[model samples]
Target: MTATDPVLRALAHPLRLRMLTLMWPGPLSAAELSRELDVSHALASQHLRRLSAVGLVELAEERDRRGGRERRYRTVHGSPLSDRRDGTPLLAGTLAHNLRERAGRRAPDSEGVTVDGELWVDPQVWQDVRGRLAALAAELHAAARPPHSPGTVPVGIGVMAFALQEEARPEGDGRPNPAGSGPG
Candidate 1:
Protein backbone atom coordinates (compact mmCIF):
# COMPACT_ATOMS: atom_id res chain seq x y z
CA MET A 1 0.00 0.00 0.00
CA THR A 2 1.11 3.53 -0.71
CA ALA A 3 1.99 5.92 2.11
CA THR A 4 -0.90 8.11 1.06
CA ASP A 5 -3.48 5.37 1.52
CA PRO A 6 -5.90 6.15 4.28
CA VAL A 7 -5.58 2.68 5.75
CA LEU A 8 -1.81 2.92 5.89
CA ARG A 9 -1.94 6.38 7.43
CA ALA A 10 -4.51 5.27 9.95
CA LEU A 11 -2.32 2.35 11.00
CA ALA A 12 0.74 4.57 11.50
CA HIS A 13 -0.54 5.69 14.88
CA PRO A 14 0.98 4.03 17.94
CA LEU A 15 -2.32 3.76 19.74
CA ARG A 16 -3.92 2.01 16.80
CA LEU A 17 -0.98 -0.34 16.50
CA ARG A 18 -1.32 -1.30 20.15
CA MET A 19 -5.04 -1.72 19.70
CA LEU A 20 -4.49 -4.08 16.79
CA THR A 21 -1.97 -6.07 18.78
CA LEU A 22 -4.42 -6.41 21.63
CA MET A 23 -7.15 -7.58 19.30
CA TRP A 24 -5.01 -9.91 17.22
CA PRO A 25 -5.66 -13.01 19.29
CA GLY A 26 -9.42 -12.55 19.37
CA PRO A 27 -12.32 -10.13 19.56
CA LEU A 28 -12.58 -7.40 22.17
CA SER A 29 -15.22 -4.81 22.84
CA ALA A 30 -14.51 -1.10 22.95
CA ALA A 31 -15.12 -1.01 26.66
CA GLU A 32 -12.76 -3.89 27.16
CA LEU A 33 -10.15 -2.20 25.05
CA SER A 34 -10.47 1.03 27.02
CA ARG A 35 -10.10 -0.83 30.27
CA GLU A 36 -7.05 -2.64 29.01
CA LEU A 37 -5.40 0.46 27.56
CA ASP A 38 -6.46 2.74 30.44
CA VAL A 39 -8.31 5.11 28.13
CA SER A 40 -11.80 6.50 28.09
CA HIS A 41 -14.51 4.47 26.42
CA ALA A 42 -15.21 7.26 23.97
CA LEU A 43 -11.54 7.51 22.99
CA ALA A 44 -11.25 3.79 22.51
CA SER A 45 -14.42 3.76 20.46
CA GLN A 46 -13.11 6.53 18.27
CA HIS A 47 -9.99 4.59 17.38
CA LEU A 48 -11.99 1.43 16.86
CA ARG A 49 -14.29 3.22 14.49
CA ARG A 50 -11.31 4.55 12.58
CA LEU A 51 -9.94 1.03 12.24
CA SER A 52 -13.32 -0.23 11.08
CA ALA A 53 -13.58 2.50 8.46
CA VAL A 54 -10.56 1.11 6.70
CA GLY A 55 -11.88 -2.48 6.87
CA LEU A 56 -8.92 -3.67 8.91
CA VAL A 57 -11.22 -4.68 11.73
CA GLU A 58 -14.88 -5.73 11.72
CA LEU A 59 -17.72 -6.39 14.08
CA ALA A 60 -17.43 -10.04 14.71
CA GLU A 61 -20.33 -10.77 17.03
CA GLU A 62 -22.89 -9.12 19.21
CA ARG A 63 -24.29 -10.76 22.28
CA ASP A 64 -27.07 -9.89 24.66
CA ARG A 65 -25.60 -9.18 28.01
CA ARG A 66 -27.19 -7.38 30.97
CA GLY A 67 -30.20 -6.35 28.93
CA GLY A 68 -28.06 -4.84 26.16
CA ARG A 69 -26.14 -6.05 23.15
CA GLU A 70 -22.39 -5.80 23.41
CA ARG A 71 -20.43 -5.59 20.19
CA ARG A 72 -17.16 -7.42 19.70
CA TYR A 73 -14.53 -6.54 17.13
CA ARG A 74 -11.91 -8.74 15.49
CA THR A 75 -9.10 -8.24 13.00
CA VAL A 76 -9.81 -9.44 9.48
CA HIS A 77 -6.23 -9.52 8.34
CA GLY A 78 -3.31 -10.69 10.43
CA SER A 79 -0.48 -9.90 8.04
CA PRO A 80 0.82 -6.54 6.89
CA LEU A 81 0.44 -5.66 3.23
CA SER A 82 3.47 -6.64 1.18
CA ASP A 83 3.10 -3.85 -1.36
CA ARG A 84 4.04 -1.06 1.01
CA ARG A 85 5.66 1.97 -0.57
CA ASP A 86 7.25 4.89 1.29
CA GLY A 87 6.00 3.70 4.67
CA THR A 88 9.21 2.23 6.06
CA PRO A 89 9.67 4.85 8.73
CA LEU A 90 6.17 4.33 10.02
CA LEU A 91 6.58 0.57 10.05
CA ALA A 92 9.93 0.83 11.79
CA GLY A 93 8.46 3.07 14.48
CA THR A 94 5.61 0.68 15.05
CA LEU A 95 7.97 -2.25 15.32
CA ALA A 96 10.17 -0.38 17.77
CA HIS A 97 7.17 0.46 19.89
CA ASN A 98 6.13 -3.15 19.90
CA LEU A 99 9.60 -4.28 20.86
CA ARG A 100 9.74 -1.75 23.65
CA GLU A 101 6.41 -2.84 24.99
CA ARG A 102 7.54 -6.43 25.03
CA ALA A 103 10.79 -5.49 26.67
CA GLY A 104 8.97 -3.58 29.35
CA ARG A 105 7.06 -6.69 30.14
CA ARG A 106 10.33 -8.55 30.60
CA ALA A 107 9.65 -10.90 27.75
CA PRO A 108 12.45 -13.38 27.36
CA ASP A 109 14.40 -13.78 24.17
CA SER A 110 12.97 -17.28 23.82
CA GLU A 111 9.56 -15.75 23.33
CA GLY A 112 10.77 -14.11 20.11
CA VAL A 113 13.39 -14.48 17.43
CA THR A 114 15.57 -12.10 15.49
CA VAL A 115 17.74 -12.97 12.52
CA ASP A 116 20.49 -10.77 11.15
CA GLY A 117 23.12 -11.78 8.65
CA GLU A 118 24.87 -10.63 5.55
CA LEU A 119 25.72 -12.85 2.61
CA TRP A 120 27.48 -12.34 -0.68
CA VAL A 121 25.81 -14.12 -3.55
CA ASP A 122 24.79 -13.85 -7.17
CA PRO A 123 21.79 -11.59 -7.89
CA GLN A 124 19.72 -14.57 -9.00
CA VAL A 125 20.62 -16.48 -5.85
CA TRP A 126 19.64 -13.53 -3.70
CA GLN A 127 16.29 -13.34 -5.49
CA ASP A 128 15.66 -17.02 -4.87
CA VAL A 129 16.59 -16.68 -1.21
CA ARG A 130 14.28 -13.74 -0.77
CA GLY A 131 11.43 -15.64 -2.39
CA ARG A 132 11.99 -18.60 -0.10
CA LEU A 133 12.02 -16.38 2.96
CA ALA A 134 8.75 -14.76 1.86
CA ALA A 135 7.18 -18.14 1.30
CA LEU A 136 8.24 -19.32 4.75
CA ALA A 137 6.81 -16.21 6.35
CA ALA A 138 3.51 -16.71 4.53
CA GLU A 139 3.35 -20.34 5.60
CA LEU A 140 3.92 -19.47 9.25
CA HIS A 141 1.36 -16.72 9.11
CA ALA A 142 -1.22 -19.04 7.62
CA ALA A 143 -0.56 -21.61 10.31
CA ALA A 144 -1.12 -19.16 13.13
CA ARG A 145 -4.44 -20.18 14.59
CA PRO A 146 -6.17 -18.50 17.49
CA PRO A 147 -5.15 -19.51 20.96
CA HIS A 148 -6.93 -22.73 21.85
CA SER A 149 -6.33 -22.55 25.56
CA PRO A 150 -5.28 -20.37 28.40
CA GLY A 151 -1.63 -19.31 28.84
CA THR A 152 -1.32 -18.88 25.08
CA VAL A 153 -0.55 -15.45 23.70
CA PRO A 154 -0.53 -13.99 20.25
CA VAL A 155 2.92 -13.81 18.67
CA GLY A 156 3.97 -11.29 16.07
CA ILE A 157 6.23 -12.41 13.26
CA GLY A 158 8.02 -10.20 10.77
CA VAL A 159 10.51 -10.88 8.02
CA MET A 160 12.55 -8.42 6.02
CA ALA A 161 15.45 -8.88 3.58
CA PHE A 162 17.39 -6.23 1.77
CA ALA A 163 20.82 -5.72 0.25
CA LEU A 164 23.20 -3.70 2.34
CA GLN A 165 25.06 -0.79 0.79
CA GLU A 166 28.82 -0.73 1.08
CA GLU A 167 30.37 2.16 2.89
CA ALA A 168 32.59 4.38 0.77
CA ARG A 169 36.15 5.13 1.85
CA PRO A 170 38.16 8.20 1.04
CA GLU A 171 40.53 7.76 -1.86
CA GLY A 172 44.33 8.04 -1.16
CA ASP A 173 43.73 8.29 2.56
CA GLY A 174 46.96 8.35 4.57
CA ARG A 175 45.41 8.00 8.05
CA PRO A 176 46.01 4.75 9.84
CA ASN A 177 43.02 2.78 11.01
CA PRO A 178 42.62 2.64 14.79
CA ALA A 179 40.68 -0.63 14.88
CA GLY A 180 43.19 -2.43 12.70
CA SER A 181 44.17 -2.65 9.17
CA GLY A 182 44.55 -4.53 5.94
CA PRO A 183 43.21 -8.06 5.59
CA GLY A 184 46.49 -9.05 4.00
Candidate 2:
Protein backbone atom coordinates (compact mmCIF):
# COMPACT_ATOMS: atom_id res chain seq x y z
CA MET A 1 0.00 0.00 0.00
CA THR A 2 1.35 3.39 -0.92
CA ALA A 3 0.12 6.90 -0.16
CA THR A 4 -2.66 5.97 -2.57
CA ASP A 5 -3.99 3.37 -0.15
CA PRO A 6 -6.87 5.16 1.51
CA VAL A 7 -6.82 3.08 4.68
CA LEU A 8 -3.11 3.66 5.04
CA ARG A 9 -3.45 7.35 4.50
CA ALA A 10 -6.35 7.63 6.94
CA LEU A 11 -4.52 5.77 9.69
CA ALA A 12 -1.11 7.34 9.12
CA HIS A 13 -1.85 9.74 11.96
CA PRO A 14 -1.37 8.86 15.63
CA LEU A 15 -4.70 10.32 16.57
CA ARG A 16 -6.52 8.24 13.95
CA LEU A 17 -4.88 5.07 15.28
CA ARG A 18 -5.95 6.01 18.78
CA MET A 19 -9.45 6.70 17.58
CA LEU A 20 -9.62 3.28 15.90
CA THR A 21 -8.60 1.56 19.13
CA LEU A 22 -11.14 3.53 21.11
CA MET A 23 -13.84 2.31 18.75
CA TRP A 24 -12.77 -1.33 18.63
CA PRO A 25 -15.11 -2.41 21.39
CA GLY A 26 -18.05 -0.21 20.51
CA PRO A 27 -19.35 2.78 18.61
CA LEU A 28 -18.64 6.39 19.52
CA SER A 29 -19.94 9.69 18.26
CA ALA A 30 -17.61 12.48 17.27
CA ALA A 31 -18.48 14.52 20.32
CA GLU A 32 -17.83 11.56 22.57
CA LEU A 33 -14.52 10.93 20.90
CA SER A 34 -13.62 14.58 21.34
CA ARG A 35 -14.29 14.37 25.07
CA GLU A 36 -12.41 11.07 25.45
CA LEU A 37 -9.45 12.18 23.36
CA ASP A 38 -9.40 15.77 24.66
CA VAL A 39 -9.64 17.28 21.22
CA SER A 40 -12.05 19.78 19.76
CA HIS A 41 -15.34 18.51 18.34
CA ALA A 42 -14.43 19.56 14.81
CA LEU A 43 -11.11 17.75 14.89
CA ALA A 44 -12.64 14.51 16.08
CA SER A 45 -15.35 14.71 13.49
CA GLN A 46 -12.82 15.36 10.74
CA HIS A 47 -10.79 12.29 11.64
CA LEU A 48 -13.92 10.16 11.90
CA ARG A 49 -14.89 11.28 8.44
CA ARG A 50 -11.49 10.29 7.14
CA LEU A 51 -11.73 6.84 8.69
CA SER A 52 -15.19 6.34 7.26
CA ALA A 53 -14.16 7.52 3.87
CA VAL A 54 -11.54 4.80 3.75
CA GLY A 55 -13.97 2.05 4.85
CA LEU A 56 -11.98 1.51 8.03
CA VAL A 57 -15.04 2.58 9.99
CA GLU A 58 -18.72 2.62 9.22
CA LEU A 59 -21.56 4.59 10.63
CA ALA A 60 -23.19 2.54 13.34
CA GLU A 61 -26.04 4.79 14.26
CA GLU A 62 -27.47 8.26 14.02
CA ARG A 63 -29.73 10.18 16.36
CA ASP A 64 -31.14 13.65 16.78
CA ARG A 65 -29.34 15.72 19.38
CA ARG A 66 -29.85 19.40 20.12
CA GLY A 67 -31.62 19.83 16.76
CA GLY A 68 -28.56 18.35 14.97
CA ARG A 69 -27.85 14.78 13.95
CA GLU A 70 -25.26 12.80 15.86
CA ARG A 71 -23.44 9.95 14.11
CA ARG A 72 -21.72 7.05 15.81
CA TYR A 73 -18.99 5.10 14.09
CA ARG A 74 -17.45 1.69 14.75
CA THR A 75 -14.35 0.09 13.32
CA VAL A 76 -15.00 -2.33 10.47
CA HIS A 77 -12.92 -4.84 12.38
CA GLY A 78 -11.79 -5.06 15.97
CA SER A 79 -8.21 -5.14 14.73
CA PRO A 80 -7.86 -3.21 11.53
CA LEU A 81 -5.13 -4.04 9.04
CA SER A 82 -4.81 -3.56 5.31
CA ASP A 83 -2.19 -6.33 5.38
CA ARG A 84 -0.18 -4.92 2.49
CA ARG A 85 3.59 -5.27 2.70
CA ASP A 86 4.06 -1.93 0.99
CA GLY A 87 2.29 -0.22 3.89
CA THR A 88 4.79 -1.37 6.51
CA PRO A 89 6.69 1.90 6.74
CA LEU A 90 3.59 3.97 7.37
CA LEU A 91 2.29 1.55 9.98
CA ALA A 92 5.69 1.39 11.63
CA GLY A 93 5.78 5.15 11.99
CA THR A 94 2.30 5.12 13.51
CA LEU A 95 3.33 2.41 15.95
CA ALA A 96 6.45 4.34 16.90
CA HIS A 97 4.45 7.45 17.65
CA ASN A 98 1.92 5.46 19.66
CA LEU A 99 4.68 3.76 21.65
CA ARG A 100 6.29 7.06 22.54
CA GLU A 101 3.02 8.50 23.78
CA ARG A 102 2.14 5.37 25.74
CA ALA A 103 5.60 5.11 27.22
CA GLY A 104 5.35 8.61 28.61
CA ARG A 105 2.12 7.58 30.37
CA ARG A 106 3.73 4.51 31.93
CA ALA A 107 3.47 4.03 35.67
CA PRO A 108 7.00 4.16 37.02
CA ASP A 109 6.25 1.94 39.98
CA SER A 110 4.40 -0.67 37.99
CA GLU A 111 5.95 -3.66 36.29
CA GLY A 112 6.17 -3.60 32.49
CA VAL A 113 7.84 -5.63 29.78
CA THR A 114 9.81 -4.48 26.74
CA VAL A 115 12.02 -6.44 24.39
CA ASP A 116 13.86 -6.06 21.08
CA GLY A 117 15.54 -8.59 18.86
CA GLU A 118 17.25 -8.83 15.46
CA LEU A 119 18.47 -12.40 15.42
CA TRP A 120 18.71 -15.05 12.76
CA VAL A 121 16.36 -17.96 13.37
CA ASP A 122 15.28 -21.16 11.64
CA PRO A 123 12.40 -20.76 9.17
CA GLN A 124 10.03 -23.00 11.15
CA VAL A 125 10.85 -21.17 14.36
CA TRP A 126 10.12 -17.88 12.72
CA GLN A 127 6.78 -19.12 11.42
CA ASP A 128 5.70 -20.46 14.81
CA VAL A 129 6.74 -17.26 16.57
CA ARG A 130 4.90 -15.13 14.03
CA GLY A 131 1.71 -17.13 14.43
CA ARG A 132 1.82 -16.89 18.20
CA LEU A 133 2.46 -13.15 18.08
CA ALA A 134 -0.48 -12.62 15.80
CA ALA A 135 -2.74 -14.75 17.96
CA LEU A 136 -1.73 -12.78 21.06
CA ALA A 137 -2.59 -9.51 19.34
CA ALA A 138 -6.00 -10.82 18.31
CA GLU A 139 -6.62 -12.06 21.83
CA LEU A 140 -5.82 -8.65 23.26
CA HIS A 141 -8.17 -6.97 20.83
CA ALA A 142 -10.89 -9.46 21.67
CA ALA A 143 -10.51 -8.64 25.35
CA ALA A 144 -10.48 -4.90 24.88
CA ARG A 145 -12.87 -2.80 26.97
CA PRO A 146 -14.20 0.67 26.52
CA PRO A 147 -11.62 3.32 27.33
CA HIS A 148 -10.93 3.76 31.05
CA SER A 149 -13.55 1.27 32.11
CA PRO A 150 -13.75 0.28 35.77
CA GLY A 151 -11.55 -2.56 37.05
CA THR A 152 -9.63 -2.54 33.78
CA VAL A 153 -5.98 -1.59 33.33
CA PRO A 154 -4.53 0.11 30.30
CA VAL A 155 -1.55 -1.64 28.70
CA GLY A 156 0.38 -1.00 25.51
CA ILE A 157 1.95 -3.59 23.22
CA GLY A 158 3.86 -3.04 19.99
CA VAL A 159 5.32 -5.81 17.84
CA MET A 160 7.38 -5.44 14.67
CA ALA A 161 9.05 -8.55 13.30
CA PHE A 162 10.14 -9.22 9.75
CA ALA A 163 12.89 -11.05 7.93
CA LEU A 164 15.43 -8.83 6.25
CA GLN A 165 17.20 -9.52 2.99
CA GLU A 166 20.43 -11.43 3.35
CA GLU A 167 23.28 -8.96 3.02
CA ALA A 168 26.01 -9.83 0.52
CA ARG A 169 29.47 -10.13 2.05
CA PRO A 170 32.17 -7.89 0.63
CA GLU A 171 34.97 -9.61 -1.36
CA GLY A 172 36.97 -12.08 0.78
CA ASP A 173 35.24 -10.89 4.01
CA GLY A 174 34.03 -14.40 4.87
CA ARG A 175 37.52 -15.87 5.39
CA PRO A 176 38.04 -17.48 8.81
CA ASN A 177 40.36 -15.58 11.16
CA PRO A 178 43.90 -17.02 11.39
CA ALA A 179 43.94 -15.95 15.07
CA GLY A 180 41.47 -18.78 15.84
CA SER A 181 44.15 -21.52 15.29
CA GLY A 182 44.03 -22.45 18.99
CA PRO A 183 41.52 -21.95 21.78
CA GLY A 184 42.61 -19.17 24.15
Candidate 3:
Protein backbone atom coordinates (compact mmCIF):
# COMPACT_ATOMS: atom_id res chain seq x y z
CA MET A 1 0.00 0.00 0.00
CA THR A 2 3.04 2.26 0.11
CA ALA A 3 2.80 2.61 -3.70
CA THR A 4 6.12 0.97 -4.38
CA ASP A 5 6.94 0.32 -8.03
CA PRO A 6 5.99 -3.33 -7.91
CA VAL A 7 2.81 -2.69 -6.00
CA LEU A 8 1.72 -0.01 -8.44
CA ARG A 9 2.56 -2.17 -11.39
CA ALA A 10 0.61 -5.07 -10.00
CA LEU A 11 -2.42 -2.86 -9.35
CA ALA A 12 -2.41 -1.24 -12.79
CA HIS A 13 -4.47 -4.10 -14.17
CA PRO A 14 -8.24 -3.75 -13.59
CA LEU A 15 -8.71 -7.46 -12.99
CA ARG A 16 -6.26 -7.45 -10.10
CA LEU A 17 -8.30 -4.81 -8.33
CA ARG A 18 -11.45 -6.89 -8.75
CA MET A 19 -9.61 -9.95 -7.47
CA LEU A 20 -8.58 -8.10 -4.34
CA THR A 21 -12.16 -7.08 -3.69
CA LEU A 22 -13.41 -10.63 -4.17
CA MET A 23 -10.81 -11.84 -1.67
CA TRP A 24 -11.44 -9.08 0.81
CA PRO A 25 -14.17 -10.82 2.76
CA GLY A 26 -12.50 -14.22 2.80
CA PRO A 27 -9.71 -16.25 1.35
CA LEU A 28 -10.33 -17.71 -2.14
CA SER A 29 -8.32 -19.98 -4.34
CA ALA A 30 -7.35 -19.07 -7.92
CA ALA A 31 -9.99 -21.44 -9.23
CA GLU A 32 -12.69 -19.63 -7.36
CA LEU A 33 -11.56 -16.29 -8.69
CA SER A 34 -11.55 -17.71 -12.20
CA ARG A 35 -15.08 -18.96 -11.80
CA GLU A 36 -16.36 -15.73 -10.31
CA LEU A 37 -14.56 -13.41 -12.72
CA ASP A 38 -15.11 -15.67 -15.75
CA VAL A 39 -11.45 -15.88 -16.57
CA SER A 40 -9.32 -18.94 -17.17
CA HIS A 41 -7.67 -20.60 -14.19
CA ALA A 42 -4.22 -19.80 -15.53
CA LEU A 43 -5.14 -16.15 -15.92
CA ALA A 44 -6.41 -15.96 -12.38
CA SER A 45 -3.35 -17.65 -10.98
CA GLN A 46 -1.06 -15.31 -12.90
CA HIS A 47 -2.74 -12.24 -11.48
CA LEU A 48 -2.89 -13.70 -7.98
CA ARG A 49 0.82 -14.35 -8.09
CA ARG A 50 1.45 -10.78 -9.10
CA LEU A 51 -0.68 -9.56 -6.21
CA SER A 52 1.02 -11.98 -3.81
CA ALA A 53 4.43 -10.87 -5.03
CA VAL A 54 3.61 -7.30 -4.08
CA GLY A 55 2.29 -8.37 -0.66
CA LEU A 56 -1.15 -6.90 -1.37
CA VAL A 57 -2.43 -10.44 -0.76
CA GLU A 58 -1.19 -13.28 1.41
CA LEU A 59 -1.78 -16.99 1.33
CA ALA A 60 -4.31 -17.71 4.05
CA GLU A 61 -4.59 -21.44 3.61
CA GLU A 62 -3.72 -24.42 1.47
CA ARG A 63 -5.75 -27.62 1.33
CA ASP A 64 -6.29 -30.65 -0.81
CA ARG A 65 -9.10 -30.34 -3.31
CA ARG A 66 -9.85 -33.09 -5.83
CA GLY A 67 -6.33 -34.49 -5.57
CA GLY A 68 -4.67 -31.09 -6.03
CA ARG A 69 -3.59 -28.49 -3.52
CA GLU A 70 -5.70 -25.34 -3.49
CA ARG A 71 -4.22 -22.16 -2.08
CA ARG A 72 -6.47 -19.41 -0.81
CA TYR A 73 -5.45 -15.78 -0.60
CA ARG A 74 -6.90 -12.81 1.29
CA THR A 75 -6.45 -9.12 0.77
CA VAL A 76 -4.06 -7.24 3.08
CA HIS A 77 -6.56 -4.36 3.36
CA GLY A 78 -4.28 -1.33 3.16
CA SER A 79 -5.30 2.03 1.72
CA PRO A 80 -3.97 1.73 -1.78
CA LEU A 81 -5.26 5.09 -3.03
CA SER A 82 -4.53 6.88 0.24
CA ASP A 83 -0.82 6.14 0.06
CA ARG A 84 -0.07 9.83 -0.71
CA ARG A 85 -0.39 9.91 -4.52
CA ASP A 86 2.83 8.14 -5.44
CA GLY A 87 1.11 6.29 -8.28
CA THR A 88 -2.26 7.95 -8.42
CA PRO A 89 -2.10 8.52 -12.16
CA LEU A 90 -1.79 4.84 -12.98
CA LEU A 91 -4.23 3.80 -10.31
CA ALA A 92 -6.78 6.26 -11.63
CA GLY A 93 -6.91 4.53 -15.02
CA THR A 94 -7.28 1.16 -13.35
CA LEU A 95 -10.13 2.48 -11.26
CA ALA A 96 -11.87 3.91 -14.30
CA HIS A 97 -11.67 0.60 -16.10
CA ASN A 98 -13.11 -1.31 -13.19
CA LEU A 99 -15.84 1.27 -12.70
CA ARG A 100 -16.95 0.85 -16.28
CA GLU A 101 -17.12 -2.89 -15.87
CA ARG A 102 -19.16 -2.60 -12.73
CA ALA A 103 -21.51 -0.13 -14.35
CA GLY A 104 -22.25 -2.61 -17.06
CA ARG A 105 -23.21 -5.24 -14.49
CA ARG A 106 -25.27 -2.86 -12.34
CA ALA A 107 -28.70 -4.18 -11.35
CA PRO A 108 -31.42 -2.47 -13.37
CA ASP A 109 -33.90 -1.80 -10.60
CA SER A 110 -31.34 -0.54 -8.09
CA GLU A 111 -30.57 3.09 -7.44
CA GLY A 112 -26.98 4.06 -6.70
CA VAL A 113 -24.92 7.16 -6.14
CA THR A 114 -22.47 8.21 -8.81
CA VAL A 115 -20.70 11.54 -8.70
CA ASP A 116 -17.50 13.24 -9.82
CA GLY A 117 -16.11 16.77 -9.41
CA GLU A 118 -13.24 19.15 -8.81
CA LEU A 119 -13.55 22.16 -6.53
CA TRP A 120 -11.92 24.10 -3.73
CA VAL A 121 -13.09 24.04 -0.16
CA ASP A 122 -11.96 25.32 3.24
CA PRO A 123 -9.01 23.26 4.50
CA GLN A 124 -10.86 22.12 7.60
CA VAL A 125 -13.93 21.14 5.60
CA TRP A 126 -11.78 19.17 3.18
CA GLN A 127 -10.12 17.33 6.04
CA ASP A 128 -13.44 16.41 7.62
CA VAL A 129 -14.90 15.15 4.36
CA ARG A 130 -11.78 13.11 3.60
CA GLY A 131 -11.96 11.38 6.97
CA ARG A 132 -15.62 10.57 6.46
CA LEU A 133 -14.96 9.13 3.02
CA ALA A 134 -12.27 6.86 4.40
CA ALA A 135 -14.55 5.71 7.19
CA LEU A 136 -17.38 4.84 4.79
CA ALA A 137 -15.04 2.87 2.58
CA ALA A 138 -13.73 0.88 5.54
CA GLU A 139 -17.23 0.20 6.76
CA LEU A 140 -18.29 -1.19 3.40
CA HIS A 141 -15.29 -3.47 3.20
CA ALA A 142 -15.82 -4.75 6.73
CA ALA A 143 -19.47 -5.43 5.97
CA ALA A 144 -18.68 -7.46 2.89
CA ARG A 145 -19.69 -11.14 2.78
CA PRO A 146 -18.45 -13.97 0.62
CA PRO A 147 -19.60 -13.75 -2.99
CA HIS A 148 -23.31 -14.27 -3.62
CA SER A 149 -24.24 -14.99 -0.01
CA PRO A 150 -27.97 -15.23 0.50
CA GLY A 151 -29.70 -11.99 1.56
CA THR A 152 -26.66 -9.97 0.43
CA VAL A 153 -26.83 -7.79 -2.65
CA PRO A 154 -23.79 -7.16 -4.79
CA VAL A 155 -22.62 -3.54 -5.00
CA GLY A 156 -19.89 -1.54 -6.64
CA ILE A 157 -18.37 1.65 -5.29
CA GLY A 158 -15.37 3.72 -6.24
CA VAL A 159 -14.13 6.88 -4.56
CA MET A 160 -11.13 9.13 -5.07
CA ALA A 161 -10.35 12.49 -3.47
CA PHE A 162 -7.18 14.54 -3.28
CA ALA A 163 -6.07 18.10 -2.75
CA LEU A 164 -4.97 19.98 -5.82
CA GLN A 165 -2.20 22.54 -6.04
CA GLU A 166 -3.16 26.15 -6.59
CA GLU A 167 -2.06 27.72 -9.82
CA ALA A 168 -0.17 30.99 -9.83
CA ARG A 169 -2.29 33.90 -10.96
CA PRO A 170 -1.42 37.59 -11.53
CA GLU A 171 0.67 39.15 -8.74
CA GLY A 172 -2.17 41.64 -8.02
CA ASP A 173 -4.58 38.72 -7.39
CA GLY A 174 -2.73 37.10 -4.52
CA ARG A 175 -5.82 37.04 -2.34
CA PRO A 176 -7.41 33.64 -1.60
CA ASN A 177 -10.39 32.94 -3.85
CA PRO A 178 -12.51 29.85 -3.69
CA ALA A 179 -13.12 27.82 -6.84
CA GLY A 180 -16.60 27.18 -8.25
CA SER A 181 -18.61 24.34 -6.72
CA GLY A 182 -21.67 22.26 -7.52
CA PRO A 183 -23.40 19.21 -6.06
CA GLY A 184 -21.91 15.90 -7.09
lDDT of each: 0.74, 0.84, 0.88
**TM-score per candidate, chains pooled:** 0.69, 0.87, 0.88
Off by over 4 Å in 2: 1-3, 78-83, 174-184
Error of 3 at 12 (Å): 1.3
lDDT of 3 by residue, 1-184 (tens): 5536888888889999999999999999999999999999999999999999989999999999999899999999877657547788889899899899999999998999988888867899999999999999999999999999899999999888888886756555546554553221
TM-score leader: 3
Candidates, ranked, TM-score: 3, 2, 1
Question: What clash count goes with each model?
Answer: 1, 0, 0
Cα lDDT tens digits for candidate 2, 91-139: 8999899999999989889898788877877889999988888898889
Higher-TM-score candidate among 1 and 2?
A: 2
Model 3 compared with the native: what TM-score? 0.88
Candidate 3 residues lying further than 4 Å off, grouped into runs, are: 1-4, 168-184
Clashing pairs in 1: 1-83
As a whole number from 0 to 100, the lDDT of residue 96 in candidate 2 is 97
Q: 2 or 3, which is superior by TM-score?
A: 3
